[model samples]
Target: MSVTHEQIMLTSFDEASARRALALAGEALEIEADAIRKLHARLGRDDSVPRAVALMLACRGRVVVSGMGKSGHIARKIAATLASTGTPALFLHPAEAAHGDLGMVTAQDVLVAISYSGESSELAVVLPAVKRMGVPVIAMTGKPASRLAQVADVHLDVSVDKEACPLNLAPTTSTTVTLALGDALAVALLELRGFKPDDFARSHPGGALGRRLLTHVRDVMRSGAAVPQVAPDALLTDALLEISHKGMGMTAIVDADGRPVGVFTDGDLRRLIEKGQHFGQLRIRDVMHLEPRRIHPDRLAVDAVAVMEEFRINQMLVTGDDGKLVGALHIHDLTRAKVI
Candidate 1:
């Protein structure tokens, strides 16, 4: 068998073709960026944004997002984003709307119809019924002068100068621009509604974001007898036993008034060893870390994690408003709660 270098055996194509492809992509990106930048400028100068914002706020029911073909995919994503971000929205497929799905929309609802060319026939079929119900239509389209835009109560121009596709036919850059525009609308609505993290958490209760935003220290902290605790005057050996018994790697030391004075950990035990002092002869307060990191029971678990990170601590004592130890929280507790 003849030996051959893998590099030498590799097939080659016209290098200019690859350069041309990249050049087209770069040109398309610049064009789309310019288009979006112009749109942003328009947002600053326009009264239409306030009008759209007011109309959405005044709506008594859900937002109905509708489109056909590629626009339909974008519309569906927009609907999901709106629903997740405090705006009640649903995607209404134009083809299905003609087959009685139009009933899902009502006078109380606001319609957001997406059509890149502003000329989807399937969407047009339901326009008369939408008008009859006296519902407002917000159209997202590249051609603002087209029938859909002309018929819409509010026309949002999402026109892109070029497609990222080399052939200049496919919905590449145009789709990207439209998707960004949808995000712009959804986020604006979220801000207009004063949507807080807690509100978002309620809508996304099963996700990590929800857990971090909604869960409090009290919800995850081990309380009462579960918390490893020792008196300030207790022997170091006895406090080590309590720490081992609770398996929290540490024990809280409280003063005569039962307020947390310090914390003793296995690490503290190691230092006691280095000092050549017998555990039986020493008190927990003599070897414990004073002014230990502590968190409030009512605080968010994510905030607790931030405090722990800032102090370079792995565990914290949960305290009540009265400055008494209520619970012990390990870093793993936050991980389990998805707050990490």
Candidate 2:
């Protein structure tokens, strides 16, 4: 809102400043790592971690995570992790919850309140209302004797010896510990639910793992009239024309019943050209590689990628159970579909 003509100027940064910065950076990481280690040891010292997991898993509704300031950021991240990993969870801003957002918390829901000092005034108001609704509370805090922890149904101690900041006032180390504890709970619930890759994919359809798990051969394969095919008796030049028109680098040689008998590719055409053979007289069967690599339509597209990479082939045919040429796939198709 205000500006001054004065500014501190430095002609250059010296090695001493760089060294001090690097040292602090390394020390911060070490402090955070130690905090997480302490959090793990605390879990071993008590049954709070398992008890917290049990409450969340037993809940018929969502896990409502709430906190203030830096702890609030960690609360949001924890809610997202739990939701994506099979537990239904949401983040409720503490200040907002006291101002009517508390209605989001139901009697069947579990409240996860995060407060480093256990004195977040906003959460103090929400805890009472949530308690009245018969909702259980899981509190994460640095002070076990703090009011928030004392009132919680389950207490998770996320205490850290000191902050990574030189002033020992910032929440760097404590926040990392809180976030990690939340992840541990989500993963525990995930394991208990027997959540599989497909289940995770359903919730993360836009992610890479989701693409690999949910995209099927039929989804990426060129099917129907788009597949490049020529009769086994067709001329080699005709197969070449089919390959060029379809732009699949190859053409399938199918029998009268539309079953793939073989495949002729650009490599075949090159060898034919080198031999100076009469492309005009040669049939597709004359140069076709018999028994083309094939896959099922129902298989995951990632599985098709494996088959293509294993055989070192760029093109593959999709065959039905009766061995009919139902579709085709080129490596480029997988790339276009973001399945590669």
Candidate 3:
């Protein structure tokens, strides 16, 4: 069929619009990437970066992060990152500092002041009081000689060549650089403090990462009567009853001392049926798989998940140091707990 004139025109317009959109996106990404590259280049030569990190490391009290407007937002995020990483920190709005919030800052603390333009008036207004309190300041600014930078014990240059915004009036590249610098500071302190994943999880208990790192097998496992279990000499039918009652798709076969010797799962029952074996006549020991996969109650649930996935099984028994069955958990339990 021949293409209509209107169809060709519409297709061309759509292609042109898509090209313009993609070009604009590419330009914006290039500008931001260049800004990051400049920051990366400066890292090797900037002695002030290490000085700031050292000062923050030596702080006996919280790091008071203060800034104005857009800088204030970045300061809050920086403070949160620091707090979560092992460095105790809090955000102090420069404007609010003039109105008694300055009391929150103590001489024991160090201050990190962020301002792309080193002349933020609100920061200027409160910085004097911070100085009077004898708190050392680390300044993040574009201008090395500006008032804020001059007053600082250490000044980190987060200056970018140009704004990512087409008009170059908005704080885009500058804010990104400032945020990146803040992250650098936090991570440096984290490394210096030997902050581990457990420490991070402690600070972020409500997050998925915290759950994965902190949740132990005992926390999610079904214990006592809820754990499907059968004596080694129990009938295969009895083991099946326990599996059905616990809904774990498996039953642990334990010895007289309550130590798990083997496990019988729904899959085992299926295999037995396929072999034309009679379930009524067999004991659990006759049909159970010896040396079932087991995990310690103290181990992380995420580790249990790895075991389950590695063995291609749906459930595992939680055993004590002596290998006695203490609990059991199905893959569904891990899924429900968001530990998978």
Candidate 4:
């Protein structure tokens, strides 16, 4: 088929269109990045940022985040982050506050009000009432001199030089800055409260991270006779049989007291084969790896994974304080539990 002049022009226009779209995306990223950088620079100069965090930390009740329009959307996310990071928080819609949702705010709660202009009409109608109820307000806004900022106990300046939008009307850079500032506040409060990973894991128990932190070795380990084991004096062939029957790719070489003296794995079989050793006659004690990696039943399953990864092994034995083998675990167990 021969291409017509019109077809050639259409293809050129399509290519130009793609290039323009990519250019616009890059410009938007640059604008947002610059806004964040400005926000970062302003952090040290703004005393209110620390004071706001301190207020939230001292709050006896939840942090109630309230805003309007795009700011409201950001406020909801901020509340979620705060709640998840150890600070009790919830989002309250300013528009709903005037219609009696203001009852959600209590004197014990700290109010975080967000408005780029610092003069959202919905917020204006409710702030005085919230203040009257003795709820301290922390205002996040671009206009420091605006009514919302003036009335607030604390003001967080989230001003951007310009919006990422071409028209400079739609909230893009400003909203980004506001979201980042909210995250900063939440993280600061998290540090102040000494929120540990274990505590965070408890709050996020449904996630893979929670499984890693909360699941104990005993929870996923094979206990009792299911744990592959062989006497140290047992023939290599017998150990191999135990490994095969248990399907753990390894067997613990235990003493008469049932204490793990060494481990015999598939890798040991490979090494013995390469050395032309007779598996039928060789004792497990002769070829087993001593000082095998082991973990206590109470240790985190994730810690078991760390040991396996560090030694490049697939299985580890679980031992009691007396060094007696109580259980065993394989890499597949961690994979199944999503601890890896």
Model 2: per-residue Cα lDDT over 151-236, one tens digit each: 99999999999999899998898998899988889999999999998999999999988899999999999998899999988988
Q: Look at candidate 3 and tell me the lDDT of residue 147.
A: 95
Candidate of highest lDDT: 4
> In order, what lDDT does every prediction score?
0.87, 0.91, 0.91, 0.93
* lDDT at residue 33 of model 2 (Cα atoms): 96
RMSD of each: 3.2, 3.5, 3.8, 3.6
For model 3, the local distance difference test gives 0.91
Q: Show where candidate 1 strays beyond 4 Å.
A: 1-17, 41-47, 206-208, 255-258
- In model 1, the clashing pairs are none
Give one digit per residue, the lDDT tens place, for model 1 in 1-340: 7656754444343567778778877888887788778677777665666766677778899999999888999999999999999999999999999998998998999998899899999989999899999999988888979999999998888877777666879887777777888898889899989999889999999998889888999999999898999898888889988988999899999877768999988787787789887765787777889998898999999988998899877889988888988898999999888888
Segments in model 4 whose C-alpha atoms lie over 4 Å from true places: 1-15, 44-46, 233-237, 273-287
**Which digits, one per residue and each the tens of the lDDT, describe model 3 over residues 238-258?**
888898988988999988899
Decide which is better by lDDT, 2 or 4: 4
lDDT score for residue 77 of model 2: 98
Clashing pairs in 4: none
**Which is the better candidate, 1 or 4, if ranked by lDDT?**
4
True lDDT of residue 287, candidate 3: 84
Among all windows of 10 consecutive residues in model 2, the one with the lowest summed lDDT is 2-11
Top-TM-score candidate index = 2
